[model samples]
Target: MITDPEIDGDWDTAQGAESPERLTPRERARGGPGVRPWLWALGGLVVASAVWAGGLYAFGDRLSEPTLSYRPSKNLCEDFKARTLSGLTGDLHKQRPMNQESDHPAVYGAVCRLNNVEGMPDFVVAAQVDLHKKTDPSTEFDVPPLADIATIGDVRAEAVSDLGERAVVLTSFGGTEQKLKVLDGGAVFTVQVSVSTYNEKNGRPATDATAVQAAMIEDMRALMAALRK
Candidate 1:
């Protein structure tokens, strides 16, 4: 077979792992027979490896990539339905499922707040959903209040208004907040989970806010778990 010399220029790998034979090209060329099988095998392996690597690079997007360990739970919104909208305008809290691939939609009257470990101020999340209206589903373009609680454009920040009966009523979430991101409209509504830690001093969370962040995440998880129903 005709093999390219460039692919496996050095046949060192072809030698057994614990091989003690030190054969050089000069010596082998002078010797009777040459290491053809090993050389060809190594060359084939190299070519195969190159092709595999090239395919991966070209199709990286289609490949499965590593992601966060936590996935969307089917029982994420159960509690919100049972206990959230109970007192507010009769049991009106809307319930929905959360997906791992994209952001969840807003449910009217579904409200939640989380406290950071740092004993900072609490963060509030208000769901401004249109359970009554023919609203679009998906997290892509979130409307104010329903899917978004916090609004900020450069040097401005505040909450939205005119939310329906199932709206969230909380202070601020934390520096870390969830956004509206809908892949395909599934009649799915968006819910804006507010995020903010106590600013006792400044409105934003402090630098050493890991504790607060952990608490917030914990609360969010708990709330989501309760919404499964």
Candidate 2:
């Protein structure tokens, strides 16, 4: 019988070869060549996690903390003179102004309400100041006017330029009510003026939306200037 030397050699090698060695419990637990890829993957994940944690610890505050340009007012009524409104409405009367202030680690807030006076056309002006101590107010600065739109239908919003980092005017109640909001750095300023539609004593139209918006913007600028650090 003629036999191929290559085939005979393969059969002889296969018959002479012993069974593969079995791994002990300790050796199996320690891992084998098959487990090397998984060990490398685990080591890579550990290194990545350490890097991320170290980065957060080193620069988290610098990246997250906001830089505030303005300071909080102790009394918003004193800071907000409402001079433009006084001119438009009339002389300031003896009505007591409402003022509130709060100071905390995260934020500082102040609110003022100047009620309607006898000599002036029936109008109320409210001013609010928010100085964010920890975070940037810009993200949520435009939210109030938007909320006003959702709450009070028929409201119109217009963006005002050259006032601050950003400014918006919200008009409602047939131009009788106007709200001006300005955001600069971490500070937020809001001025809202509500006047009667008609003057009963003078028998004249009271609300001039354009004039009110102008006055509101001017006064808001003044208020922002007054509260700056």
Q: Write the per-residue lDDT of candidate 2 for residues 69-159, one digit (tens) a residue.
A: 8877888898888887777766433478888988888889999988666456367788998888876677677665556767566677799
List per-prediction Cα lDDT, in the order shown: 0.35, 0.76
Q: TM-scores across all candidates?
A: 0.25, 0.68
Q: Please, what are the lDDT tens digits per residue for candidate 1 over residues 1-229? A: 9986675635455544322255566655544234446777898999999999999887663342322222333333443342321221122232223322223333222232222223443333332222211233323233444423335422213322332212222223344554321112122233444344334332332432344333333433444343323
Please count the clashing residue pairs in each candidate, in the order shown: 37, 0
For each of the candidates, the C-alpha root-mean-square deviation to the true structure, in angstroms, is 15.9, 9.4
lDDT of 2 at 65: 63
